[model samples]
Target chain A: MTDFAIDLKDVDKLYGGVFSRRVHALRGVDMRVGRGEIFGLLGPNGAGKSTLVKILMTVIRATRAMGTVLGRPVGNKPTLARVGYLPEHHRFPDYLTGRQVIEFYGAMSGVSRHERRKRAAELLDFVGMGKWADTRVRGYSKGMRQRVGIAQTLVNSPDLVIWDEPTDGVDPVGRRDIRQMTVELKRKGTTVMLNSHLLSELEMVCDRVAILVQGKVSSQGTIDELTVHRQRYEIEVSAGDSHVDAGVRKALAGWLPDGALEGRLEGGQTLKANFDSPHLPALITVSTADAQPVQPIIDALRNARLTVRAVKPIRPSLEDLFMEAVTDPVTGRTLAPGAKEGA
Target chain B: MVLRQTLAILGDAYRELNAKKMFWITLALSAFVVLAIACVGINSKGISVLWWTFPVDVFNTAIVSPALFYKLIFIGFGFKFWLTWAATILALISTASLIPDFVAGGSIDLMLSKPIARLRLFLTKYATGLLFVGLQVMVFSVASFLVIGIRGGVWDWKIFVAVPLVLLFFSYLYCVCVLIGIVTRSTIAALLLTVLFWFVLFLLHSGEQSLNLFKLNAEEQTATLEARAEPLSDQIAKSKAVIAQLSEAPTDETAEARGRREGELATKNASLTGLELRQQSTAKDLESYRASLGRLKLWHDVLFSVKTALPKTSETMELLQRVLTSSDETSKLEDAEQQRREERGTRRRDADAAKRDADNEADRGGPGFSPSVVRRQEEINRSRSVWWILGTSVAFEALVLAVACTIFVRRDF
Candidate 1:
């Protein structure tokens, strides 16, 4: 078994063939999920997030894929016993009760009868659906169906669970329950791969995340690793008498050799001095996660008798990383959502 | 694992059908039919409905044994009309959405994500489509079995064969339904197309049967005509020999002898002319029959070839009849009816002949029927091996299912 719960290498999916219209849904993607972590897969609509998940689940065959899910080759049927999946917009037969739906899928996953029945009861309660377990799905609201969907996913006690929008259509309370469920599943050493559009929710719970744009992964890492370069310390100061820009520029003149200071610090952190504000306080920014690099600037402002109003450290949010991934660098606009056409 | 999955799907199918009001509705209808069958009784004097007796001379117990009579009714009306046609249509309407619902976007993804192989999952789902018919037929057959046993005074286990035969018959059409359901993914399209396919099959089967009847009748007529012509031809030759011998002048013959010889020659010559005319007429009849036989055989062969490649829905159900009652019993019933009709006199005969003529005219525009024509048609049908009937049909179903499965397994749900 591999150390990773999911190790996908060079995965590719082409929806249609040469003679027909084609959609290169997934490019050559290489992704890895650690054994016991919540890996969030964030992307825009049609960005191939679901396509990649389905390929791993064997719901859609890949044009070419090399990976292992749950320590077996991708698309291996038996290995799916250890891998649970809750598809987006999943539909259960309306005739069945919520409990029956769970047991049915559990049986399909090759879980024994007694075990699945026991787990189904427990999972239903775990998802807060125990009260409605015997209710037919036909009578369920969308949130109820979502709760049952999550319950069915864990019925087999899978080691790796892939949930595509687990909180879809769920109420806030139910969403929190699902979030807690993932954490509970993690506490038991289960790998959870979440694909959702809710970046804040993922930011609250995900341990690591991959950002896919136009069928390619733009970046993938822990939140800190991804936002490190964008992390900065900003020092806002004011001249008690005169314009803040002039006071700040005059105070930092020694720190600038050519009347401007815009370069990397000695420790390879980016540094820029801003003095263009006429009415606002001039700002000095350092592109490093460390606070020590900004202390000297704070001391220099104090020595110049310029009041240092605030010195704050800032780090980019998950939404910021997501937006940057989807936005085109040259166009300064969001890239067209969805997989690119052609090969 | 496979067994668990199979049972799970089967259980799901039962629940699905259980939820459909049509399933129970069809079952209730079946019970009504069985009860209706049970209420009708055959006494020595006549046929009875509950307490009331309507005397049917030919169909009475004196003419048909109660066992054979009830068997015939069950096979003809119950099995053929209700189970195979009416209930099958009901089952089709109830279960038509099976595959389309299965492969619907949200549903199929969950199934495909399961650990079961795609082919197994697809085939199991397809089989569940037949489950509606299977349950309907099973309940109907068991009920009919008890009806026949209690009312008819015979417990024929062979009556239970309807379960499998009807299931097989339903599957033939259900397979087509599944293939269309997979391709179109629309319940209405699947149902309508499957019914159309069944109609085509029925047409082909009926065409082949009608042509075979005509062809067999023509062959029998040709044999009869040939049999009649032989003696007439021999007599004509003898008359010619006698006339030729007499036509020569005799040496030292008296006038009376000559006159006698001339009279004899004239008689022989006249008889010869009459025989030759009859021979010509017989030859003409033979030619016509042979020509008709040739044409009938050609058309029958064409339909037979086409029908051979398709499922034999009627013939498959007919197999249950063959198993339930022997030909001897059927023939006895037929002979008693024939005797009763013969007692009615020449008027009945004339009407029968006129009807036969009309029937022959209707059947491929051919003429004639031997009493053995019906039996000959039965013989032709019975001549088909169970293997050929079911095997080729299943082969057709398998082909359609294979195509459906290929699409199902390869499709990106």
Candidate 2:
């Protein structure tokens, strides 16, 4: 079997027929999620995040696809028995109770009656919905429904679970519960794929992530790999009434030569010396995550009797990676939000 | 796996119907209808409602048996009116939204993501929609079975056939509803268009039957005219021969005898002319009716072919009539009723009144009541075999469902 729970290659989805207005929802998207890992999919609104998840679940047919989900070709009916999906804005029948909803979906997934009954109860209590298990879903609040939606997804004990906006309409406590459940699923060797706009939540739980922009995957990798190049260290020196006191500038004169204040250091790392005029600290930024390179700058400030207030290492966040993926590099403006229209 | 999925959908459908107040309301109405059937009784004197007997001569128990009366009421009022018309309408209204709601955005996503195939999912849901009518008809048939047994004193097991018959009849229309629902995804459109389709079927059926009645009437008229013409033509030939014989005097005849022969010859000629006049009138009528018959047959055939290609809703329901009552029993009832009417006519009519009434009746439907218009209509309906009635209808339903399944399977929710 393939190591990935999902291995999609060159997937494309065109929404309408020739006579109608068409949308190119997904344009050659390639994505992968390794087994026993929590993978996050982040995108702007209408960027085809949901569309890709749907294609894997066989909810939408792709125009051109080459991939396997759980070691079977995409859209294979039998393969879905090992997969679970909680769609965005999923609506259960109002007539069914919470427990009935779970049991019904479990039965549909080919789970036997006794197992369905047992799992439904356990899952309901796990989601903290045991008190409302017998109540009809029509009377439940949105957060309650979301909890039930999550419970139903796990009824079959799927090997791969894809949840789109699992924490939508949920309170903070509920969101935490969902996160913990996702982690628990991963701990049990289940591959969890989550698509949500809550970047912080995904950042906390995801081992790897793919950022989609305008129907294409702009970046895909572990957080450390994606943020490695953008990681840096900031050295702030105390500024006098003149913003950057003469002592601070004189101390860093080697890194910032007279005519060129920003240049490469001896270690071949980018070093930019900032001397602000207003009442603020004069800063030195080293474009390397290694702490060895920043020790000399701090030593120079100290030997010159210049106050060295702080030296800190900064790593780009998932949100930062998300913003960079969606932004137009040439224009320095955010890219248009939606999938493009095509012939 | 398929069985489990199918049972899940069926269970969901039952729960959905259980939640709708209309389901319980319809069941209550059916009970009331059965109770109402139980309240009305046929007795030795006449029809009885509750404790009161309204004296009637023709429909008394002596003329109609309790078994036959109850069967008639069950087939006529219970099956035809309540189950076919009223209950079917309620079923359509309640279940019209089933397909549209099933394929709705969020709902369909959940269903389609399951391990089941799209075609199987769609078909199971479609069958589940019929659960509304199936349950309704089952309850109605069971109650009527009890009523017919207890009240009419005949525990006819055959009454249960109404359950499947009515369900089949409703399926013919429900298939159309499902097609429209899948296409438009609007409950109102599906319900209205399905009802309209049924009305068109009713109109076509009525048209075929009406044209057949006229065709039969015209054929009867032509036959009567031909029968009258034969004797009149013989009489005319005989009169002419006698006149010819009398016009020439015998050699031994006296003048007085010859003059008497002349008078007799004149009388024969006049009689022959009158007979010839009737022959001319009959020939004219024969031509008219023959022409009318040709026109009626053309239109009837046209309608018959059109109706043949469509589901036979009326004929499908009439299947119950065949299984419920024997032809012999109905014929006996009809003969008794006819004899009673004739006896009443004898008491009410003198010679003049009788002749006037006969002429009036002749003008009404052309010659001798057309010899059982009701029986002829029943014969036309009964001539339809089970295969033609249900097979063609099921073929039509299958065609419609095929189209619907294609849409449901191909559509992206």
Candidate 3:
């Protein structure tokens, strides 16, 4: 069995025929969304985020696609019963009440009427739309419509839920609630693929995220892994003289990994750890581009006859990674994937 | 499970149509219109358009059979041209947007994303659009039934045949609308094209009918010219033979032979000249008549083929007559009436023409009598079988739907 809720390889989608001006929406996209994880797809306006989500949801057809959803073949309708979708710019029938809209969609998903009613009530309240349940959607504000739209996405109780711009018109509190809801779904073992322009919202809740640039997966990994600068570590060495003993200095020289630090420790402060965390106060801070362990830094500080106040690792924010992934090197502030040059 | 989804989509479609205020308004107007038509009762005098009470005194209870009179009133108002037009156009325009709206991008995504098959969804949407026609006509038929019972004192439930018949007729045009709507995704464009299609069908049907009548007339004229020329050819041949025999006769002796030969030659010459003149005129008439027939035949062939290719639209609607009118008894009355009229000879006429005038006016939109006229209506309907008329129309609809569904399923949202 596949280890993913969705597994796609070499997926390509081109809008219009070859004779026309074809827009390549997705270019050889290979994606794996693991089971029971909240995966965010972050990208620009035409960056193929929505198109990718839609392909998984079977809302749009791919020109050349090979994949499976729910571990079955892609575009499988029976498997779609276990998948839910909320499209971007979705508009509900204006004549139906909010409750009716949910029930109607539930019915479309082959949910029993009684179950639809029960689920509608619970989901409407869950989305803070209980009061507006009986009101026609035409009179509801965009935020309210988004609330209903979200509630409807859960109507089928799908195992895999794909939401495109789920928090598009949502207010701040609603965005927070949506984030919380994503976490809750993850806890319940639901795999969610969230497509959103709200990078900050995604950063808060996403376990893993893939940044798409020009229809390609430029970078992808866990939030921590993507943002962390592993080579950089801060050793909080107190700025004092002779808090160190002679034996401790010798231990510091021996404890350091051979060639781990580029420069040697000398009588002054030459063989110190170079990188540090940005959140800490004035102390000894060490930074390096090399990937290494943190234990050595702790050991070195302990040997230096000074208290290791804090040994911290520094990392970039999600925005910094996103900018670095999407922007051109020459015209952009970010130097490269691993560069900390701008910061 | 497909059934449930079908029902779900069908239910949603129902709700979509039900949400329109125009549907209800049209229903109300139909009810009012039908009940208002039921108010009048016909008699020998004339129709009472807005009858509030039974004016039994104004009607003459004698002359025609009361049952025949009441049936005339029922059929005349119910099947009149104006009512058919109004019902058809109103029901069509109101339900025009159902398909376009269902296939609208966001809305269609919700449906197509379901486990339901796309073709089934499409078909159910079609059935849903048809539901409008079904409901509208059923209501109208029932009201007409009640009216016929209450006013005409004719409680024939068969009047309800109009329900399916009208639905079938309206579908002929509505199918074109649906096909256009799928291609264009515009409600106004669909409705306009459907109307235009109906106009073209009307022109073609009328053109065929008129051309057929002209062909029949030309054939009759040609036959008459051929019969008139036959005897003239015989007379010309007899005259030429006699003229030859006289020229061959040997000359006898003296004044008696000369005088007799001169008289004989003069008489034969006059007779030959007159026969030749009549024969020439007759031949020219035959040529003119045959030429007319040839032209009519050319047009007739073109129209007949065009008519055959199209669905039998008017005939499909006309199928209502088989159930609406009394067939057997009406046919006997018509046969006897026609026999009697034929016996009245060339110069003198009968009351049949006057009665026919009154019947035509009533059928146009009023009230009068004739069990005989029902035979012609029945004959026109029976020319095509139930299967032939309805089957061809449904085939047209199916072809269009197939094309639409193909476009719908293949195109990416």
Measured by lDDT, the strongest candidate is: 2
Across A135-213, the per-residue lDDT of candidate 2 in tens digits comes to 9999999999999999999999999999999999999999999999998999999999999999999999999999999
Cα lDDT tens digits for candidate 1, A1-343:
6799999998999888868988899899899999999999999999999999999999999899998887889999998888889999899999999999999999999999999889988988888889999999999999989888988888888899999999998888988888898899999999999999999999989999999888888899999999988999998887866787666666666555466767666677877778766666778898989998777778877888888888889999999999999888998999887788888
Q: Per-prediction DockQ scores?
A: 0.81, 0.76, 0.54
Kindly report the docking quality category of candidate 3. Answer: medium
Candidate 1: docking tier: high
Cα lDDT of model 2 by residue, B154-272, tens digit:
99999999988998999999999999999999999999999999999999998998888888778878888999999998998888888889888899999899889988988888898
Kindly report which residue stretches of model 3 are placed more than 4 angstroms away from their true locations once superposed: A229-312, A329-343, B50-84, B234-282, B326-382, B385-388
Better of 1 and 3 by DockQ: 1
lDDT of each: 0.88, 0.90, 0.72
Candidate whose DockQ is highest? 1
At residue B267, give the lDDT of candidate 1. Answer: 88
Pick the winner on lDDT between candidates 1 and 2.
2
Query: Per-residue CA lDDT of candidate 3, range A148-227, in tens?
Result: 98899899898988888889888888888888888888998999999887888888888889988777788888977775
Chain A only TM-scores, each candidate in turn: 0.96, 0.96, 0.79
Q: Could you give candidate 1's per-residue lDDT for residues B194-287 as a string of tens digits?
A: 9999999998888888888888888888998999999988898888888899999789999999999999888888889899999999999999
Candidate 3 residue B294 C-alpha distance from true site, Å: 2.9
Q: List the residue pairs that clash in candidate 2.
A: none
Sorted on DockQ, highest at the top, how do the candidates line up? 1, 2, 3
- List residue ranges in candidate 1 displaced over 4 A: B239-278, B345-367
Q: How many clashing residue pairs appear in each of the predictions shown?
A: 0, 0, 9
